[model samples]
Target: MEYSFRIQLVAIVSLMLVFPNTQGWGEDGHTIVCSIAQARLSNTAAEKVKELLPPGNDLASMCSWADHVKFYLPWSSALHYIDTPDNLCTYQYERDCKDQNGEKGRCVAGAINNYTTQLLNHGTDNSYNLTQALMFLAHFMGDIHQPLHVGFTSDRGGNSINVHWYTRKQNLHHCWDANIIETAEERFYDSNIDEFIDAIQQNITKTWSSQVEGWETCNSNETTCPDIYASEDIKAACQWAYKGVSDGSVLEDDYFLSRLPIVNLRLAQGGVRLAATLNRIFG
Candidate 1:
């Protein structure tokens, strides 16, 4: 790299060293997705999920359970994302997923399909299986919509791209994961996830709501088509998440303001699709 670019990269990495909260979406973002899904869930689906979770755990609260258990299930860490090749901004399950050490049917798309099958079988399996399936579905649905989660493999889905968030220093992946949603909530709803979900609930445009069927229609055997949802995130990551961003990028109000609609739409779609999947399983 050129000397100037190298210097910029070092400066950005230094910023990341100081900033905190670099995990996926933090708890707040997951809560928004799960809360929306919980509100829209059918009574039957709601009852079904409730019975599977431990006492005092609902979809919203248990949304983070997958992240917790992932520590124990080392093989499951790959279940959270599908890393597309660099700059292409698209996904072919065979092209992207197989490269992660040849684990077939085990990435986010595969996990969704696997868990969906398990949930549909319902009581045919142990409660442990059922609960694990539910948690993965709840979490991965949100993960799929997080654009960075489907980003370039070269950058580990943007995790390696150091940039400053208005001089605070964070990675591009972290910016999408935790910053954008948090900033959007505070700006639009005063940090009220409930209110944000409610507004989305009321205004779920016909186009996006219709997408639930479109996404589910993807055929598993048809090359990349089966994982269109993952592809969607990859496209978003290319167009918006990494479009203007580079090493030493300094993000601020203009960037956040422009991205709010994108964030909200993804959250809304994630919630609705999650409900649709669960309803299919339980209802």
Candidate 2:
């Protein structure tokens, strides 16, 4: 019995070693998206958001609230992502977004649709519902853009792929979500999240102004477009994010420097598109 216990304990510790981290692109990434959206929101949209949030809490503060509650609300966990089939390597709504139970159109993209409708039409239904929609939208918007969140089923969105960031061991998913972005901030932005995001917003506004319409138009007021949008992420993850990653691979400066643009571009797109959604719903 003692030997069996030791074996179980070792397995638990080994799993924990690799899985130790928060879900989704770390809090900083989500907050950066929300904050940029807040900055870009029209006066009316900003006012509406301020009215929805709890007193003293802003959009950025509750950006990760969905992840926090997914423990108890297990039904919503799969709403964070849609897994493209391993061989498929693409996000087809009819193919991928049947939820974990195979229920059609109930993935993160679906969640965005439902929550957006709720906020747009029934935002005043009650405080609880209003808050739920706002939190879901804020979090899901960021999730759909993380690239890995729209990643593969075979490896559990890169979670199953063991990797090392330089010398520290971690999985590909967490590395993209947390480590890479964290390291990017430290190296390029002096670890200043605000300054980095602000500069990203400015650069996006100046350099990608025309592209905003293309991206924002990719998502309509309806939910049908989120699938199309998520496909963009899945394709990106396949061609860019998992490019060189392999079992026991050590990723260093080249990987980080090359992928920072993707991280920044996705962040920029998320913020701008979020602002567009809010403006339409509240305008």
- RMSD to truth, every model: 10.6, 8.7
Q: Report the C-alpha lDDT of model 2 over 1-283, residue by residue, as the tens digit.
A: 4345345434543453345339977888898889888888899989889976756777887787777666546788889888887746687777788676789878888888888888877535543366568878988999999999998888888999998898998999988888888998888889999888888888877988778777767433453257766988998898878887887888899998889889889988888778888888888
Which candidate's lDDT is highest? 2
Report how far residue 44 has shifted in candidate 1, in Å: 1.4
Model 2 TM-score on a 0 to 1 scale? 0.88
Local error of candidate 2 at residue 145 (angstroms): 0.3
Instruction: Tell me the TM-score of model 1.
Output: 0.84
Can you give the lDDT of residue 94 in candidate 2?
77
Assess candidate 2 and give its lDDT: 0.80
lDDT by residue (tens digit), candidate 1, 121-182: 76676543666678878988888888888888888988888888876888888888888877
Q: Count the backbone clashes (under 3 Å) in each candidate.
A: 0, 0
Query: Which parts of model 2 have CA positions greater than 4 angstroms off?
Result: 1-21, 123-128, 218-224
RMSD of 1: 10.6
Whole-model Cα lDDT of every candidate shown, in order: 0.75, 0.80
